[model samples]
Target: MTTPLEGLATIVGPGNMLTDPTDMAPYLIEERGLYRSSAQAVVRPGSTAEVAAVVQICAEAKIAMVPQGGRTGLCGGAVPAGLDRAIVIATERMDRIRVLDPVDFTMTVEAGCVLASLQAAADEAGCLFPLSLAAEGSCRIGGNIATNAGGTNVLRYGSTRDLVLGLEIVLPDGRVWNGLKSLRKDNTGYALNQLFIGSEGTLGIVTAAVLKLYPRPTERQTALIGLPDSQAALTLLGQARRASGDAVTACELMSRLALDLAVRHIPGLRDPLGTPSPWVLLLELSSSRPGGLREALESVLSQALEDGTAQDAVLAESGTQRQALWRLRESIPEAQKHEGGSIKHDISVSTSRVPELIERASAAVADALPGARPVAFGHIGDGNIHFNVSQPEGADKNAFLDEWPRLNRVVHDIVMGMGGSISAEHGIGRLKAAELARIKPDLDIELMRRIKTAFDPDGLMNPGAVLIP
Candidate 1:
């Protein structure tokens, strides 16, 4: 008779079992510092088979198990908070590209493969794996699929859900569901593979996936535009898309406060425009067929300027300029960190109502906290705004942070009234689980509970997560 710890160690090998507090430090914490959890051990499994074996042992011992990816999630989805009687099943060791079929436009990759690495692999194969985000350099593919991640590219390529052709998941009770098929069309009976795609590791642990790939873009046009307001962004997006034959891949909206913080705090970053505007939009168009993209972009941009759709614009002449423009958009969250305590909201309304959402939320938060600065920015292309509130100048960070709950209600009430999502791109990890339970309809909660029960009867699989314990 072997103990559960011994059993796990035997399956993954002793070295892969991190039992020491020092060795397990990295795995026990969440990315946003919201959760500092305790895990009995951290086991790294190099393959799907090893993961399966580890799960089986945990199930037999009645031990709770948390399936972890790169831990890049801001929400506490990967954090096993309050589940101290658990072990973290880290997938970092299971990284391997099983297959890359350029002809079929698909790649079979293990869960631990870093997203940027996969993107580079696709690029090397003369294809595009466009599920890119700021954290692509370190975030693993498994977490992306698990959260159904939406990034700057989602305006064009869609989210992680769209990019996945199929998934291979390890069930709660140690069963492996091998649905890793590369086919684009599979009218199979239940579409069970879709179950775990955005399940956030609650239903099951994702071990591998068949990811969709697109043709590599031969030409790209990047432009940062000054906008009069959020409504103007909507108008410009529609006009640009229609004029450019729907080549708009990304359109990010940034508020003045957001751009100002980025330019001021982020070293070596300067505002590209001569005159400042209330809002800025980073619009990018990419096409595999070259030669006409720039002309079309320029033509529409010129028309936009004349028609008052755009106030001012700066088109990237080189890769360096393109990168500089992106740094401004990407650095907003980091810049907010420097300003002190910040409360974040990853909310989304319909694409048409983005301006309303921004306006209402901004006003609501300001009235709630008069001096608080609103930093509104994100994928305006898809209606998802990272509505974050930076503390008033020289404010005590922790004291300001204490108002998170109150400010959340102020903004969330506005979002809910607009028929928008409280957690848009970021999945409802442990952090938002209670709010999700409170605001969602009873029937919606019931259906999700039933699904959770069907998949994880014992509640040992990531309990206290999306469907909180």
Candidate 2:
């Protein structure tokens, strides 16, 4: 028998409940179209009280709940699958910037606020909330906190966990745990906010958060460099960091093939160097106190080039030029998608071991899939590599995707052998649950389960998500 969704809808209002298949289509599928499942209904809660109430009602009726934000997650974390008795509680209607304090250097915002908008609000006040991702325009603050996002700026600012000061969460029993404080120093007991930051909505529903901010960067410089390979790139990175001190904000790496895909698939993306190389690095340096950071950064790059660590270089001549370079980096994923299907891996190792990791893992993948083209790129400075493989030209996508499991095993084995992580910035949603179960030690899984049972014994909050049943 289908439980009456009408009763719950009455509390929030008829307009908030979406039961029609067409109306709930967007929420059912994940971003990459990897996971798709139907829901009993989709609910939009406008306030924290409404969220709590929905949780309470769901608990009473024993209906599972999935908390969804902007639905831009690469993982199937937000998608509802094999659960017909569940309703997606989207925080879309709760989009609001609650408060901003320039003096305290913190911004308290509702979970539904878009990341780009939050950054804009802070920028308007002459401050910066440095949590940035490719999906920043569409992804919500709640999801960012839930995943503990790490982006290009992680080398300088750290992850989303570091940016959060406090959080307001709605517990499984429909009670609100208000910890939304904007204080810089609070050494009180166990810091509860950290637990929910990367919990993926398995522990509680994060309704709002107090985020840290910093003084805006006054000057910025960006450059593109050609390196022999990952080792040369690493050497160049170390040199740049030593020369510029803390000014090297980002150090992203790319392969020649990856750049070619961007140039061919994405419109108006031109190679600034007007030449191709086997490997490249996109380095950006910024300083709050500066007349110009470009000269300092270019001098460092010049030294690297002369030292043979960097073979060729192109410094951004203007702000427009800077965005142009970044555009190629940002368009890599989409460009790859347009070209062909790929097997994606977001793995991380120590910054010093990145070159070795890439070499070993890439060779292993190549051996496993004979003609697969490796398209590895990402924040090398922070050791997070989006190691993906595009299908060979005019190859069958089904055949390429068929090697997903074997490909993942080969890469993950190397990552684990190096004391690294399979999922770096991205959390273990439904996509990596099997890998998490296999690679994660038995003791670690047991401890995580114990904590989950202690917090939510019924297994109601985002059931069958991180933990494999």
lDDT of 2 by residue, 75-161 (tens): 899887767678899999888988899899999999999999999999999998988889999999999999888999999999999
lDDT accuracy of residue 102 in candidate 2: 89
| Count of clashes, each model | 0, 0
- lDDT per residue for candidate 1 within 1-469, as digits (tens), equals 7899999999999999999999999998898798998888999999999999999989888889888888999889887799869999999998899999999999999999999999999999999999989999999999999898999999998999999988999999999998999888889688888888888999999999999999999999999999888898988889889877999999999999999999999998999987698999999999999988899889878988899888899999999999999999999998988999999999999999998888888788778888999899999999899999999999999999999888888888888888999988889889889888878899999999999999888999999888868
Cα RMSD to native, each candidate?
0.9, 1.5
- The TM-scores of all predictions, comma-separated, are 0.99, 0.98
* Runs in model 1 lying further than 4 Å from the true structure: none
> Highest TM-score among the candidates is held by which one?
1
lDDT of each: 0.91, 0.89
Which candidate gets the maximum lDDT versus the true structure?
Answer: 1
lDDT of candidate 2 vs native? Answer: 0.89
Q: Cα deviation in Å at residue 182, candidate 2?
A: 1.7
> How good is model 2 by TM-score?
0.98
Error of 2 at 343 (Å): 0.5
Poorest lDDT segment (10 consecutive residues) of candidate 2: 1-10
Error of 1 at 193 (Å): 1.4
